[model samples]
Target: MRAEEQVEAVVVDDIAERLRDGSREALEEAYARWASLVHTLAVRSLGNHHDAEDVTQQVFVSAWNSRHTLRPDKGTVPGWLVGITRHKVADVHAKRARLARDAQAVAENTLPDESAPPPDDLLATRLVLHDELERLGEPRGTIVRMAFLEDRTHDEIAERLAMPLGTVKSHVRRGLLHLRTRLEEVDRDPS
Candidate 1:
């Protein structure tokens, strides 16, 4: 074997021996020796250093916690750590996939259908209509808002405003024409 690999194998063998004898320092030495390899594997699989760090921590915690269950006769320390790292990496991938699916579901639920007018266009139209109504002012604006927006009838408007029925009808017709003209002008010259 190469120099570093031979040294690593020796270190792994030593750590395994310490662990089997219930040495308290074995776990720390195990983490020091293998943490980079575990973290590197996690980062490659997860594509993010933050997630890789979390997985690396989880792998060591799981290894330390389950140290008593390990069979040193059946496996080396590095082999056991590699298994733990695999499981941690899988868990991270599952979490990332779940988060991605949840975000997609939320977007689908909140967004309008593709066929509908875009939100910005709808908002701009409402604002422009409101501005034009304000510019109309006085009886025409008030009458139009009541008749269309409030769903009021001509008789209701005339009696509410204390005016002649013919005057309310005239205002409704002229206001509609004026709004149509204003809207058409805006549509033609959007700038």
Candidate 2:
């Protein structure tokens, strides 16, 4: 290998070790190595410097926060970083689209909007809900989603899934309990 290749190999190895050990420094080095490429990708997709910069920062921040979930056996760190950046960019586009849609709805609504204002804390609540749902696994997650997102009653979900009503209720109750605990943890975290 060339001298530069040797240095690159050493850096990858160091990063892999640090990542496995859950070291923040390793996560920082990994971000430093890929931030430029991630930024370029964001710029291309977003077509603006400010949006690209925002996406780039969000990508690294999310990646660092979720670093413990990284699997070295899956792919190279750079590839993983690219995947994270892509997802973040997609999220930015989705949010903008949603905002535009909401604005259009407001323009069209003739009725006095008496619905309670949308929760400002909804994003944090959603992230916590998703994380907790993932931990709850299959039937519990299904039941929770059905009840909350689909507006299905427990009996309705049970009938749809061909599960007993009692089982469905248990899953919903357990899922909510798990979400409550996870939300408490997020609230307690200083960062």
In terms of lDDT, which candidate is strongest? 1
Residue 159 C-alpha lDDT in model 2: 77
Candidate 2: residue 166 lDDT (0-100): 96
lDDT of 2 by residue, 106-128 (tens): 32442223475446466566556
The TM-score between candidate 1 and the true structure equals 0.54
Supply the global lDDT for candidate 2.
0.76
- Candidate 1, which ten residues in sequence have the lowest lDDT sum? 102-111
Largest TM-score belongs to which candidate? Answer: 1
lDDT of each: 0.77, 0.76
Cα deviation of 38, candidate 1, in Å: 0.6
The residue ranges of model 1 lying beyond 4 angstroms of the native Cα positions read 1-11, 20-22, 114-191
Model 1, 1-191: lDDT tens digits are: 99999997777778887876777699889888789989999899889998899889998888877877677678888788889999988876765565455435533543445687667766566666677766766567677777776678999988866669999999899888988998888778767
* Runs of candidate 2 exceeding 4 Å displacement: 1-3, 110-191
